[model samples]
Target: MDTWRQIIADDEKSWVLFEHGTCVVLTTPGDDLAAQAVSVLRDSGPVHPGTPAADFGTVPLETTPGWVITSHHPDVLTYVSPEEIAQDGDNTPLAAGLYGRSKRDQDAHSLTVIHVEDNRR
Candidate 1:
């Protein structure tokens, strides 16, 4: 039997599960990565099947092409722009599209950018 890596905890309200090889980020619902689908805990604090919190932003790591994950809260944000991810690198794009206007693109096939409607979108 193959072992699966699962993230669960109370302080850890949100989580991003990366595929073993693809580095794809999978989320629960509104998470779109997995179609808002996850094993939800019934009542316990941190049950075997944890409940999925509402996901917001999507951030694509500039370091790798296929490495994409959900952007956590501002304090918990994970993905960083190429400029921030690295500095003084030849591969850095002259026109790094990280800002909203630039619209940094990511590995579309391997990743999922989900934005649930909140009276916005």
Candidate 2:
């Protein structure tokens, strides 16, 4: 089976499984990529199993610098600088449209923002 299929089958991680071929895995600020892959699945909310991946195409998370968003899907991820986030307002429309009043609403999807330490500084 494919890697994603295997992961889905295992169901042992914090995965925002969408209907399309896209999946967003969440991790704590201190968790490494490898660690997150195998870590026990935690409780996640606002799972939109019926929503298409295209709806999340523009949602951006405000995180610490150096935090990278990796994805196998072409053109599925983008880096949003702090300046851009600030200019967009306290709460971005894109995020509001998806997350709604509660960070994780039953009617919309939720995003988990992880802030990693900048070791270079």
Q: Candidate 1, 84: how far from true, in Å?
A: 7.0
Deviating ranges (above 4 Å) for candidate 2 = 1-51, 57-75, 91-121
Model 2's TM-score against the true structure: 0.22
Q: What is candidate 1's lDDT per residue for 1-121, written digit by digit as tens?
A: 0111121122223333222211222222243323321222111111122222223244334335312223222222223245443454533332222221112112222333343122112
CA displacement after TM-score superposition, residue 4 of candidate 2 (Å): 23
- Weakest lDDT window of 10 consecutive positions for candidate 1: 38-47
Q: Give every collision pair in model 1.
A: 28-36, 29-36
Best by lDDT: 2
What would the TM-scores of all predictions be? 0.23, 0.22
Best by TM-score: 1
